[model samples]
Target: MKPLKEVAMSYMALSEAQKKLEEGAFGEAAGESSKAMEFSKTMPPGETFDHDGFDALCYAVLASARAGLGEYDACLEASGRALHYFNRRGELQQDEGKQWIAVVFSRGVAFHETGVYDEALKNLNMAGEMITERKGELPGKEAMLKEIERRKSMLLEEEKSQRKPGYKAWWEFWS
Candidate 1:
């Protein structure tokens, strides 16, 4: 098992990556994110059966790191894993709807940024529905979902005109 100190160090690295990204240093961010991901991938689910929120949160961080690296598919995989971990433990409310929606919207944003409009729309639409359905019931999510979909619509025309040749081959490889 990894030591707690080591774990904290890795987490600090992840934070640094986030800061670099905020500073527009994408290369530095990607480097730090890669280091963080290494530790996270090796982290055990633990000896006993406890889907504590920590594991889910770790996956969330991984998803964020992947997003920073422009690895949209990787981000989606990590986010979905996070969501699954939380769902299995019925930690949705504790994790909050916004966190889950964040997983979806982040994937959508990644897809959109990568010019994969079809995937972007699918995820954003799902997020929109989730946000709308939970808005009245969930806390801290009244505006976020609305904003994400609005952003999606802004790219509608751009996506429509982006159908390049042989995209299907690359798409299937990713799929």
Candidate 2:
């Protein structure tokens, strides 16, 4: 078994990597996140994610990191693994449910960012329905439904634009 301090250090490393990712340092963040994942395998589960959730979080971040690195399909597959792992936890477990919603939304956002509208819409709508059904009961669920709606609107516009003669890249302004 790994020492408690070692596990804590690894947890901090993953958090730092996520911060770097949010700050747009993709390469460094990916490396750090990978290291964090490897380190986490040695530790026992405490809270938040059971041992499995910890693994899923590791893989999910890896997938998001891959998305940031412009590998969309890999991101979707990896994020799917995360969602599956979360879903297997328990239907009554809102914590895991929340985690699934997050991965779904994140993957949807990533896919949409990379111009995969169909897949993005499917996942976004899935998340919206889940949140809508459990809005009052779920904890820490701020702005998720609204964000899903916003993404859906953007997707609808993109779909419209795709039918026109002059379709624009997803990253560009579409007005």
Candidate 3:
């Protein structure tokens, strides 16, 4: 079994990766996230290997880095993995909805970039609702709320553009 010190170091690495991801340093974030994941693998099986929140953190960082790199599919995969981990521990609604925020946001971004507008809007709205419900209790609450509003606005614009009238029906063209 790996020592608790090693687990602590892994979390530190994950934190660095998340910072790098937020800074738009995709390559550096991926490297740091990989190191954290590798360290997590060194722990012994059973209770000693319980990952607290490190697994979700690493996956969230990975997803954000991949999204920054324009790897939307990979970002979605990583975000899904993070969501899976959170779901397993029933932490999706824990911590005042903080735990699932990053994962949900990443999934929303990935879906948006991939042209999956419905899914994007759904996930983004979920994140927005969580942010709204948890308001003052969440760290960076204002920033998160602003971002959610921005994305929702963007999605609405895109939806409106798609619905704009222009083309004629086949029968009308024949007429």
Each candidate: what lDDT?
A: 0.65, 0.72, 0.79
Model 1 C-alpha lDDT per residue in residues 1-175, reported as the tens digit of each score: 5556557666787677657655757667657766765665555666332333544555565565677668788887877777785556533334355456666777787778777778888888887777766634654365556667676876786765676855565669788
Q: What is the TM-score of each candidate against the true structure?
A: 0.53, 0.63, 0.78
Query: Candidate 1 or 3, higher TM-score?
Result: 3
Model 3 scores a C-alpha lDDT of: 0.79
Cα deviation of 109, candidate 2, in Å: 2.8
Model 2 has an lDDT value of: 0.72
Query: Tens digits of per-residue lDDT for model 2 on 104-171?
Result: 77788878988888989998888777776654465435567777889899999878866857656687
Error of 2 at 77 (Å): 2.6
TM-score of 2: 0.63
Query: In each prediction, how many residue pairs overlap at the backbone (N, C-alpha, C within less than 3 A)?
Result: 0, 0, 0
**lDDT score, candidate 1:** 0.65
- Model 1 residue 4 CA deviation in Å: 12
> Highest TM-score among the candidates is held by which one?
3
Model 3 over residues 1-175: C-alpha lDDT tens digits?
4468778778889888978876879989978998998888777665366574677778877887887788899999988988877766645446614647867887898898899999999999988876766544666667767877898899999988886497666898799
- Model 1 ranges with Cα > 4 A deviation: 1-53, 68-73, 86-92, 135-143, 162-175
Ranking by lDDT: 3, 2, 1
